[model samples]
Target: MWWSLREKRRRKMSSTHLHSQRPKRTMAQKSMKNPRSRSRFSVKTSENYIERMPPEVILKILSYLDAGSLFCFGFVNKRFQELANNNAMWYRFYAGQQAKKKNPRLIDEVTDGLSVVGIQERPEGYWRKQFFKELAGYNANWKKKLKAIHLYTGLPSQTAQILRSLRVRWAVTLTDGKGRESTSEQTHVHFTDAAVTVSWSAGDWPFIDQLTVLKLHGVVRVPLQCPDEYKPGWKSLLTKVKLNKDVWKLCGSDRLVKLLYTEQGITVGVWQEQREIAFIMVNLHYHQLVERSLLGSCVVQYQPAEHTAAFDDVDPEYGLHGYAAHIELHSTAGSIASGRFSQLFCTKDQISDGHLQLKVISKSNRSQHAPLCGSISLPWRTDALQGQIEGCCMLTLTVFDEAQIPFWCVSAPVAMTTSEQAEVSYDCTGESFFVRYEDAEGKVEIELRWMEDHKQYFMVSLIIFLSISKVNKHFGRDYLPQ
Candidate 1:
């Protein structure tokens, strides 16, 4: 399919591309009138100096040429063609391009693990060709899908989720505007700090591949029923993280009015006694309370690798009590899968007395046959220092790995008056593990530099604080801030 499609496209391009761009009175097109005359353009070359150079030197030169330039080099001559199409050249291109992409198919194909048919007996230029072709196909498909589709817009996060829910790739469990669970069959939902994407079986969602998302909605082939309002609601993207019974004491389960994720951060709307919804934004990066208006604030937390949030911070010099998060474990670590990690956290607080209980879990931490390092019960508890805590708070938890290691740590802010929580998840098998942390407090964000690296995985946590935004009092019933 790849070879055939590539040849067909090449034929199409060769027939009309240069012809359409060529001028009518070009020298080459007019040359047929004087075939018998050897016009006057002639330069006698002694030998092909380029081919005289060692092949290794030629390959070195080819390495500097990018994908486009390399393909163009093939048109120069036979030697250049062979050098340009060399496996070494395209392999480097393939490796580099694959590193930037989220898809693993290219890597699998080159590594002899490709599941696709007719990809086995490929030549050196095969990967390089596919790199451009697959990209072209993917982008073109998105463009076609995006043309004239009417999506629920405004809040970018909500828009993405709405489109995802409606354009199913997999069966998803959704609660409609009136709070009814989605009964759609055979669906899967996935989440990350930055995006929430849902996909279901192709057979289930007939028009899913054909559906398009418009960040700014306009005209559409099908009439979409969406009201022009800030429609905020709960979207369950993380399969592993759930609002269990323990944390509900802080924010009642019934009070959660809405949940959505934006590029900036995750925001929530919860019902309050004042007959209004509190708009709270939780910054997952830095794990600090970024914004809140009216109601209680929301914090997003994931179980940390090093149990850094487990520290019991108690200093004799200070008045209030809270714990800081981490102490480095090592400069270099082993594989990302099934191993222990060290995470650190530093927290500052005003309220004085409360024990923080954290629950830790991992969706990929499955190792039934692995040896039991130790028997352990998670959602561990820690108390503030002698009920009298000080300036900076740092906490660390040492979790024993029975099999696979836990990836994130979740805990309540030690002594804050109004503590609320939200769940954040990431696609762990990514090339860039850590997502940028956004400061919700309108403070300058300092650049963090790390010396070491590992396979891409996510380290996400939430920061929740009480809202200082005064209530918006309209002439009568209610008015929420935009």
Candidate 2:
């Protein structure tokens, strides 16, 4: 009996100890489930989750975020700020923002981030001081984001430094409009303080080309030894100045050939003497001529060559003079001589000097008595007629055939004498006849005559009279008879 009681007591005690240990284990697990009780584990879990994501994927997600979001994220920790400030990363971000919209806040954020990372090693206040100094030097408005800059007096070091730091590519313009008045003034300066050095990684400058650099100023300095792919946009600034063969040979044989002929469309052959220097003007189609690369090489060879002969005779006046005429006579008959009549008159000053004489040899086999009639018109103007030379008026002769068909004519109008006598004679067929004249008005008159004493039928002629006066000073000479 005593042994049984002892064994039961021992079993109960052992069971009670095991139950107490189970409660302790359950309480420990409940404490772990509560977050406040497991702060260290929660931190470890968060770190592992972040570490699982790739840095590039994180950056991509950050790129889609706005500047404000990035700024907020930057304050999350030092690691985030460093990621936000990476040059390649931010460069793309800033470029995208600038392309989409002109946001001052975005620029400010970018500049601020850049300034922070750029001068982190400097003194505490050194960056601020330098920032203001550069700001003043650039005359840049921090409040307003910059789109373009015009550096007239050469780019300053501070400005260049800021541009380089910002990875900003810019074009340059050099103008010579200041010294136009002074003849001895030098319009352009050979050297400028705004020298730039380009270090390219790609085979060629992709975003930058001849078209983009239309406004680049001064000569580009080529490195003594450079990569074969690296061309310096023509290092010499000898544009529009002719180059000698030796000088051109330095530009490469193929380049010289292209410069002389193919590029300019100028068929360059051997000349008597080499043209050391000549201004070359390129006549290209609109878009092609505007290209900076084409203009750079082409302007060196602009020489105003004399135009070659394209025609046999090119006169300044009476351009390409030739003549064609037709003659027909009708005298109570159908037609006399009508065929193609072409005549080219030589350039004669007499034709314009009120004295024109043209002889027509008939091609038609018709006899001369077949009522031959012809008319002649000059290519230029003739002199106007004046009246009464020493009480004798000048008259122009017109000849006609017996059938009253007019043949030859003169430029001068017939003028009759002032006498009322009806016996003034005009030699028609070498015969003298009487003609009558009357002065109806001052410097104006009329004349009449009868042919063959036929009283009922009268041969009438008219004239307008004029008198000569002292030459006006403005005219400076006597009147030329017309």
Candidate 3:
């Protein structure tokens, strides 16, 4: 009886110890019990499950997305960023983008069949860099500005005559930012005199002055277009409809802001007090132009007059005798400037057979800032004007800026006279005659020398000296006391 009572007491003590060692509830058990906690827990597990997926499956899913979407997906996680930057995939994306360009080139065709193995072997991030480079250009807004200058309505009589008789030729070139040039296949615009009128603007924007705003009446030839490889840095050369759209500006030396409309493409030049003294038109045939070459040397061309002497049977007074005008462009080095001069346009009242004479006077030299040198000889059409000197004889030389747009016009007449157009002054030597025109805009001095051979007039040498002035002013309105 005493042993049984001791065993009962031990059992009671053991029961009490077991009661004190009871377990607490676990987190998993709590989550299972609560509905909101269960949903939150499941979401975390699902994200981890996706992260643990094989790279091949993840990449396959990403391949279905567009370039922009795939690029954004990289922000999700480190693993996703690695998958998104795959060079082979980006290469394909880039090729697809190329195909969407207005004038898609053969580049897309060549890349179409590229094997995965070949694309994979490219440098790390190579295709990604290329794609972003192209995208930077593509995403920017391409724009140009158009305005009409009263071509005929209000002008000086002399200026009116010049504008009425004005003729232009369009030429285009491609530039690679570096000093490289590619001229157009079709050098001249089909219609040289077609002006960019409000009609060309197509009623998109209100004209500043409709009465002064001329309308392009006739059917106009479409502007020239370039392939993708030859695309210009600016979109102005490509589309006409976008003229009214807001422009995206570029930074740097090649920065082009406003494009003034004339006949063909836009004209880039300096404006003073809301007046355009001179401008060079970007040839309608091309959208963009680059500096053709660096300047090397300046040159001088001279031919001495011939003296009729010795025993000659032929009469001194005879046959058709007219003069040919010669131009010489010199460089800082006193050597002839190399590369092609911008353009030469001559207008005369009495001479016949007026034509374009372009001669590359010197071979290109490896130099920088050398003005492009060229020679032009304008001779009277031998078909007309046999013997007498008639009316006004004028030669216009238009000088271009780095953009190949005419900024200054040097108009040199055959005869030296004080006229309403320009103040005429001359410095005459036994060999040559120098006529100079200077104003706030710039300075232009042209040298002309007459050469005589027998009874016939041989050649007129013209040397043009040009200088541009940079003038800046603070903006404010001047007021007069009432």
Candidate 4:
């Protein structure tokens, strides 16, 4: 009986010890019996599930986010902070934004990596800076946002011919009645015998009934047949004009009723020569708004370049056909230090080529200086030469200094057909044609003359007028402050 009792007690004690060793039901497991408690338990366990995901997968997910969202996401955690600040990622993001631009295919085909505005490469933090700049520019209030006002007019056959010969260009400035003004970022105008385009960027807006002013500087003149009331404003070609409240109402109410509104912006075409302006179109919203106001009246048809999606898309097939020529730069006048010439590049539309590295051969080498002189011969019909300028309507030559900065640039139309070659009767002496370009820096004249008969467009001469101010700026001091 004792042995039986002892064995039973031992078995009971062993069972009790095993039960004690087993873990008690956790609070979570105890709550699992209830549906709400089970839901709460799951919520607490999966909080760090994304942190457990593979880094590449997380990045791929984040890639779909915009710049603003990406910036916000950087604050999520340290690991995310590192990924969001990746330069390569931001570059790709910026490139993707560029791809979404209008006619990106053509832009890519022509410029390669060069932007139309001359932005060459994506530097570190450029993406963020551009993003913020665009955001600020586009989202500013009506008074602060950039406004573009375009004025179209017709040129007589005689006036157009004179403009072509003089190579006239216009620079315009817009100031609101309040005195705030903004210069145009880009003044692109394709001058032909028929239509002339003029536009300005407005920084401040004039309220209704205020006098909006336009100050323009150019050498071309159109006959002004203004009413007696408006005669006070019309003067020289380079003069200011103030439009009053009555003229504003007349412009938009009667004449410019048929204004065109497209996805790009609002455009009012007035074919009347007597009409100074048809309407004042202001881009108030992001899309743009067209306000019509008639200045004067007459009907004259004019043909500008073939209107396209973009203004500068003059000829998509320009320079596709091959032509052979020799291009040379000559120092015609003024003085520049020796060894000033470093590189020469030619770009027109989408075509660009680095022509040569120039060496300035001077008669004397001293601390003083000699005539800004250098000659570089670019053989256009060679295996090494990739671009041909034979059929191109226009081309731009940019000369770089020793520091690889643009020292001088000239954009001029090429002498292509016999008509163009004959247009400049004065300059087209023999089988030679000349185009001249002048700016605040200096003047450059390009002489495209034939050598052996008229079989080939043989050679080009670029003569630079080294103005004192330009030379002084190039050398980094006021050497000659004219």
Q: By lDDT, who's the top model here?
A: 4
Q: Rate the local accuracy (lDDT) of all candidates.
A: 0.30, 0.28, 0.34, 0.37
Worst 10 residues of 3 by lDDT: 289-298
Residue ranges of candidate 2 with Cα displaced over 4 Å: 1-9, 16-29, 32-136, 140-482
- Which runs of model 3 end up more than 4 angstroms from their true locations? 1-54, 71-81, 93-117, 128-464, 467-482
Q: For candidate 4, give the lDDT of residue 130.
A: 50
lDDT of 1 by residue, 1-482 (tens): 99999999999989898899877865654555656432432324556788789999988988887666677677778878877777656655655566556465554445435433334346757865655444332223332333332221101223333334233222223232343332233223333222232322222211111212101111111111223122112122222122211222221123323222232322222333432223322222112111111011122222223332232244412221222221111101111112222232222233112211121222344221122122111111112111111111111122221211222222111111111333232422222111112222111111111213432222222222211121111011122222
- Stretches off by above 4 angstroms in model 4 are 1-395, 409-429, 450-459, 476-482
Please name the candidate that would achieve the greatest TM-score relative to the true structure. Answer: 3
The alpha-carbon lDDT assigned to residue 105 of candidate 1 equals: 51
Q: Candidate 2 on 97-151: residue-level lDDT in tens?
A: 4434555445544444455456455444343233323322323342132222223
Q: What is the TM-score of each candidate against the true structure?
A: 0.19, 0.18, 0.27, 0.24
Question: Which rank order by lDDT, best down to worst?
Answer: 4, 3, 1, 2
lDDT of 3 by residue, 83-186 (tens): 98898788986786576674546555747566778888888777876775465442222211112222321111232222222221122332333334333322
Q: Write the per-residue lDDT of candidate 4 for residues 1-482, one digit (tens) a residue.
A: 99999999999999999999999998887787788877777777547887889888888988887666776667788988767765545655455545556444542443335553434245545555554433322222322221322111111224433334333444445566787764432233433212233332232334333436654444222112333222211111333456444432111112222222111112222223433222322111111111000111112212223312212232423311111111222211111111222223211332312111122222122232222122221111111212222222223344444333334443322222332534343422346545444446555554444434444332333444445455434444333222
Clash totals for all models, in order? 37, 10, 12, 9
Candidate 1's displacement at residue 249, Å, is 76
